[model samples]
Target: MTWWPEARDELARLWVEDTSRQQIAEAADEIDRVLAVDPEARGEPGPEGFRRLTIRPLTVQFAVEEPDRMVIVVTVRLLTD
Candidate 1:
């Protein structure tokens, strides 16, 4: 089944205005691709059915909805000190 992944509002904002805008966009693209195929196999399972995946300077939390074939990317944040 195909999956539709959506980044949350804050993450989308980061894509447009953050200094690491380019990288954030690229990471979101990759998240869509990876989650599309086999979401269950991609991220490490987290609490309450959420999963976490890290791509470079960002880490995203996502959940798969089997009935809707959707992947909701609930959180995306830059890894900063």
Candidate 2:
């Protein structure tokens, strides 16, 4: 069961800072790996078909489309520095 985890344009803003960008990028990579393997088993469920996942300073909202074999990440946020 492979899934393609995609980040939306809305997440680009969080990568502006050099420091945060590296951290976020690393986290994003890990996110893709995890989501690709098993998205439904992870993350906290949210309303309106959205799911929330937090990787340290980054929090992301993604929706898993089983039929499409994709996890569409809709939003991203940095919790701290």
Consecutive 10-residue window with the lowest summed lDDT within model 2: 1-10
Candidate 2: lDDT over CA atoms? 0.72
**What C-alpha lDDT values do all the predictions have?**
0.75, 0.72
Q: Write the per-residue lDDT of candidate 1 for residues 1-81, one digit (tens) a residue.
A: 222334467776776777887877787678788888888889898888889988866788888887876877877788774
lDDT per residue, candidate 2, 1-81, as tens digits?
Answer: 222233445456667754677777888778777778678878999889888988877788878886875777777777875
**Largest TM-score belongs to which candidate?**
1
Clashing pairs in 1: none
Residue 55 of model 2, lDDT score: 86
Task: Candidate 2: give the clashing pairs.
Answer: none
Q: Candidate 2 regions off by >4 Å?
A: 1-7
Each candidate: RMSD? 3.2, 3.5
TM-score of 2: 0.76
